[model samples]
Target: MSARTVLLPALAVLLLFALAGSLLIGPAGLSTPEALLGLFGSERGPAARVMREIRLPRSLLGAMIGASLGLAGAALQGYLRNPLAEPGLIGVSGAAALGAVLTLYTGLSAAFSLALPLGGIAGAMAAVVLVQLLAGREAGTITLILAGVAVTAFAAALTSLALNLAPSPFAALEIVFWLLGSLSDRSMEHVWLAAPFMVLGWLLLASTGRALDALTLGEEAASSLGFRLPAIRLRLVLGTAFCVGAATAVAGAIGFVGLVVPHLLRPLVGHRPGALLPASALGGAVLLLLADLVVRAIPTAQELKLGVVTALIGAPFFFALVLRTRRETA
Candidate 1:
């Protein structure tokens, strides 16, 4: 059997295992069979309530959010031809967070819960447009990354400023929880709110795999091969904005899944950016589910934030990547 076939199935299985663990490994301490029964069977009580209300939504969100991040990461890395591109690095996540925070600060979220994701979507779209404008079409990879860094810093400053000047203590608290990134107390309402946007984003991104493959040959060559650069760029930008924005709206600005998952799966896909997308998505789902599970399993007064665990793991890997790239260049 080919490696791609084997690797893809293995990743899928890993994701399933992680999903099962996420459902079964919560504080309820239900066994696998009991959890499954609670999830699917007509059993009334705490097990069913926990299964339907808590674990299900959390697990679903983890998988969807991770997939969105991973897919966006692969798409960006493929199109930009850069190994270091991600939503957080490029300011998209920060902008999305700012939008969600705006809803909270303005009391829109309190009045209308759906307003939160909508605001985040708007913020993410604005960031995408801004980033594209900052990084001109002919810009080099270094130039693009620099623009991303500038935008990221600006958005982060704005977010911090919002937190500092929040209208009420509750607003500040909301911002703090969001900035840390947790899936605690999430509901099926969140699942319903974010799923449509996430699904649309996945479709748009998945459509670009062939275009990304053509892009590896350079813009001129890709154009000559009948790929419209404008359409591809729009798809990637809008798609990423929708996915990441919805993710941030529901779960806050969880970072590093996009950056780490694609990087790890790249080699396994034979370094083909096109082939790496699905692998990264599945790998990301696995990683996030596992991380969420670990956070729940740990004994602490308060659960560790999902983003904190990912950062603790991802920051070291990012540093290693930078060092390796520097060594290779040197």
Candidate 2:
């Protein structure tokens, strides 16, 4: 059997085990039997309430958001034909965070529970438009990357300004913490709100698998294979916007899953970008779920932010990747 054939099943099984761990293990200290009973049984008790309301939503969001980030990263790297490419390379995450910050800054989030995420989604869509306008129609990869950098810088500056001008220290602290990212206190309402956009984005990204496979032969070769480059680019941008935007909206600015997962899993799939997509998604989900569990397990006065944990893990890996890439080129 080929490596991919083995890899996919292994990853899926790992994901299932991670999901179970997420549901069963928590600060509440429920036993395995009690957790299972709470989830499966219809008892109207505290265990059931914790199982269904708190852990379940947190687990589901972690899986979905992680999958979205992973899938988007694979798609972006494949489309750009650059190993360093990631979902945040196009400014979607920064813009989404800025949007969420704006909502918090203006007190809209306090007024409306969904305003924060809605603001984030809006910001992400706006970034797409700004990027397109800056890159112009028929722009190439280099041009698109440049435009994304510009937008990211602009959004980041504005976000900082919001922080500086925040009405109070508490408001500033709230913005800072939200930017740091966490999955605590999330609800099923968030899951329901973000699910449709993420599902649509996944379908769009998945459809490009064949096109990405062809593009590996060069854009000219992909064109000769009857893949419309313009159409492919459009789908990639929109799909990424949907996935990353919604994820940032719900989970804050969790990073590095996209950058790290595909690179780690690439060789196992024989470096086929098409096969990397699903594997990366599963890998991302597993990574985030495990990270969330770690956040709970750590004995601290306050829980560490999910984004902080990911960055702590991912930063070292990123430095190693940079050195390795440089050595390979040298």
Candidate 3:
């Protein structure tokens, strides 16, 4: 059997295990049988309520968001032909966060919860459009990345400014911690809000796998092979925008999952961008679910921020990657 066939199933199994682990671990600490009953039973009791209302949504969102990020990362890296490319590198997440922050500061979310994700989608679309404009039609990878950096910095500054000028202390504090990201207190509404966009993104990104594979030989070669570069780029940009935007709207700005998952799983998938897409998605879900489980398991007074945990793990890995790249260049 091929490594792709074996690895894909293994990753799927790992994701399922992590999801089961996510359902079992929580503040209430239900037993396995009890958790199962609560999850599947028709009862409206406390355990069922907890299971149906909270943990289920959280687990689903974690999987969806992680998959989106991972897949987006893979798509971006493949399209841009740069190993370091990721969704956040292009300001999609940052702009989406800014949109959510605007909704919060303006009290639009209080009026309507759906407004938050809508705002995020708008921000994300706008940012992508602006980046595209800045990069121009014929721009290269470096130009595109530089444009993204500029947009990211601007969006981040605006987010900070909103926090600084927050109407209340509690609001500021909430925004501060939220920027660190978490899956806590999430509900089915959040799952409903973000899942559609994330799934759409997955579809868009997944369909580009063959084109990305072709482009590995270079744009001219891929064009010669009958792949339309413009369509491929459009799908890549829109896919990342939708996935990262909705994710930030619901879960705030969780980072590193995208950047780490594809890099880790690439070799296992024989370094084929097409094969790496699904592998990265599953790996991302497993990694994020495990991280969420870790935060719940830790006996701290307050659960650690999901972003904090990821950064602590990812930063070192990032540094190691940098060193490796440096050595190769040397």
Best by TM-score: 2
Q: What would the per-residue lDDT of candidate 2 be over residues 107-195, giving only the tens digit for each residue?
A: 99999899999999999999988988887777288888998999999999999999999999999999999999899999999999999
Residue range 1-330, candidate 1, lDDT tens digits: 988779999998899989988888988888888888999999797889999999999999999999999999988899888777785665678888888888888888889767877788778878888878887775355555676678778888888888899988877987898778888888899999899999998999999999899888987898899988877876787788888888987888888899889988998899888999899888888988988988998989978999999899899999999899999999
Q: Estimate the TM-score for candidate 3.
A: 0.96
* Colliding residue pairs in candidate 1: none
Q: Which ten-residue region of model 1 has the weakest summed lDDT?
A: 138-147
Q: What are the per-residue Cα lDDT tens digits for candidate 3 across 129-159?
A: 9888887776266777888899899999999
TM-score for all models, in order of appearance: 0.92, 0.98, 0.96
| Clash count, one per candidate | 0, 0, 0
Q: If both were scored by lDDT, which would come out higher, candidate 2 or candidate 3? A: 2
**Model 2 weakest lDDT span, ten residues long:** 131-140
